[model samples]
Target: MIFDEFDPKEDKIFRLIDNEGQVLNASLMPDLDDEIIVKAYKEMLFARVADEMAVSYQRQGRMYTYPPNMGQEAIAVAAGLVIRHEDWLVPVFRELGTWLAKGVSLKEIFLYYMGNEAGSNFKNAHHVLPFSIPIASQVQHAVGIGYSIKLKKIDEVAFTFVGDGGTSEGDFSEALNFAGVWQVPVVFTIQNNQYAISVPVRSQTKSINLAIKSYAFGIPGIKVDGNDFFAMFLAYKEALEYARAGNGSVLIEALTYRKGSHTTSDDPTKYRDKGEETEWAKADPIIRLKKYMDHKGIWKEDETALIEQYRTEVDKQFEEAEHFTPYQLEDVFQHTYVDMPDDLRRQKLEYEQFLTWKENRK
Candidate 1:
């Protein structure tokens, strides 16, 4: 019994569980078997550890630029759990957690961040496309994939993750419109993490809720508490079912916050207040979920120790990633196309010769 008493203007913010780990809506609870609960806990733990390790790796110069999803573990893990492995995941850059949940290898992910072409090679087993950095471009790709699935009469759906800023893009609007008109099976998840770089949500749009924007496209829209794993799971589960049943696309605006800087290069202190970060930290998704597990007697001290041990392994993996040979200058030319243009071929040869001369001098 998800809350039906939502105000389009105010109650669009659906919350089944509060930040203190209290269940606000009993109906929103999934049929939590012990096995499922434990699995959720493990996923949450892994996400947190991966996030921390990514930050540390970036600082150690083992990884290229990285974004930290410290507080939004529940949104990614719960959504991932609800979707099938065969489903396509079209993720934006901030959705590393979502990609991980979709069966992307940690080594491959590290390789991508380390500038290796192998990082983007998980195309077959993992239906996840490479992470898109151009904001709303991936939304169109999701819509396209969904359209193709519908044409093939396949029972598959595409999930596209974007931020509040992406909602303002023309691509976002076009994708939603196309999905609605074509009755494509897709889930457009807008993780509204408050600020779009330095722009606040208040200035992003005049609409009261991002979910309501879907109404204009003639699609069902729902807003969920992104930090509550159960709530997000339920919302996504319902939306996915609706799509599979040929009800077309659904828009889910997950109201959440980014608890850290936008990326390793970002400085939140310049644009946002420190108090806001502290506020979100107290309501951290991992902490709240751990509390919930503790109250249910599902979390144990020994299990925590095991998770820490896993973190140590992750650290070791990062060290291994550092030893991978960086891409050679000539390797870039090989992957550019099936047949390199004559000009590019000549340039490649010249660059290789220059590198050889420089190496001989050294």
Candidate 2:
């Protein structure tokens, strides 16, 4: 299935890949080199398996609270591939897919979510920020980084990830305003995963589309099919190049559905309709990508085999992560600040005294 016509637009949603394994725009189709395509496929599979493992760990009480990035695989992998090593990545909490693409080990993420704060260091993760769980806070960080880069005149861009609901945040608006006036090289990629927690997009904004909001800030924006790997890859590449060229910022609205709950603490079934989920399931991005690869003869392995490989890698990583020293009460004191505050120092001392007293009583 091949459809090749035009590129993505601001007012209209851009989708180069379709549900039936069709390439909507053949001319604009990115070079799906076998090596890269296969790598992308395996990465998507790994993201999926790792997401599933995160859920499993949470249920078994081995992991801390985490937001699952299950169905958002394609967008992350595509964006990751296009982003250069020198550029910075400003991320919200739910960007496991992009993290993998940036070459961060799954072990790092597994450790972080498993309650080891050391994982936050991300040893080799150059130019990547710590995960910002607060809504839209990372947008400001990206804008700040964009400004710093411009001051230094570094030929680098910053890609920031946000969500549908995050757009409503005042911080996002401020970031966009500053980015526009400063003309920084930043790309704000919104993962419009339809629903934000229990709130649907329709309930949040009356705007025709999310990307078009960039127009107010004198920047270009496009809404692409988040699930289509081809569209995601090309769109990100285009945006990255545009920003790097000093043409100001770009906002990307990736239209897709969150196939699962917002986080381990959430239950989508309580709010979303089953029918809606089934509809989105039919358009599973990974499945479509796999089909395209199979038809092109680049990916010949059976689905079962591929998944088995994914499970083996993911499971092994999970096992290794378990050996990390467990999080302890003292960590609260240890990690609070580099130079411990006096009040916190007093609190830690009190805690230690209490522990000693309890031990003596025993």
Candidate 3:
């Protein structure tokens, strides 16, 4: 198995493609059909376009502080390709490509950032949890879902994502411990994008690599080149198989770089060097995939025209989200508990009264 071959404890990273899109390991390359390869490239392109547009919208004050999934698209795109509709996707604030792949509309994503609670209500998307902003809390949620699936004897797997920094959180360790003990069908992915906002991975942990943390929990772990889509695909595919067969959960550390800022509110230039950014840009997932497709003669779409089309579609969705119904006051307090606590009810009433008083003065 790939996991056994490239053990995380050895600090060996599995890679199939190089920066120039050359297949470094032909034997390790997945035997995907030409059409599927084309689809993956298209999805990655759309994700890039959408991500750039989302950042633009936030800069224009059309949206809130949005996280950019610039260089980390391959990890999500690969996971999206592997994940079935019945599988659960427990995600952090990022993973835009995965969300789109799993039937989430751009409008819904925009609405969520626009403070519209309706955005969190992904009516069409199935088995996908709302975006988790708190550090590693969602890791536990993914484990719990996996446990439920195991108890019910379901065939579905639970896939969860966390940043490299999140690996230090107690919730992450606790969740992995439970998942290992229970042998739940969970695939834990750590998007080791070099930083957690301002802190680098070196500061996050002293382990040889993030994937090695899984060893403590008695689960299989693999470190992969996140920029190489084929490597990620193979990792997820194998991880899925291992978990699905009732062996146990697997942890995959996707080594990648976050080219964009931590969020629209923060400036990457303050903490990231231009030279480093340029170096990482060379390994961009979209560019690499396009180059691979170019070599294979499968990338037949007109680039300029396709980008224009994507821009128009993204803009239209942003406009729809911008003009979405204004957020209601009750939305903030209603979902926290099945029955609203008296303190929360009183706070909601106070906010309503304050709004009324402020409006009356106008």
Candidate maximizing TM-score: 3
Those runs of model 3 whose alpha carbons end farther than 4 Å from true positions after fitting are: none
Tens digit per residue, CA lDDT, model 3, 91-111:
998899899988899999999
Clash count of each predicted structure:
0, 6, 0
Per-model RMSD to reference: 2.0, 2.9, 1.2
TM-score of each: 0.94, 0.93, 0.97
Q: Candidates' lDDT values, in order?
A: 0.83, 0.85, 0.93
> Which candidate, 2 or 3, would have the higher lDDT against the true structure?
3
Better candidate number, 1 or 2, judged by lDDT? 2
- Candidate achieving higher TM-score, 1 or 3: 3
Q: What is the alpha-carbon lDDT of model 2 when measured against the actual structure?
A: 0.85
Steric clash pairs (candidate 3): none
Kindly report which residue stretches of model 2 are placed more than 4 angstroms away from their true locations once superposed. Answer: 1-10, 326-331, 334-338, 357-362
lDDT value, residue 121 of candidate 1: 79
* Residue range 88-175, candidate 2, lDDT tens digits: 9999977787887676777788887876877687877878987888899999999999999999998899999999999999999999
- Please give the RMSD of candidate 2 to the true structure: 2.9
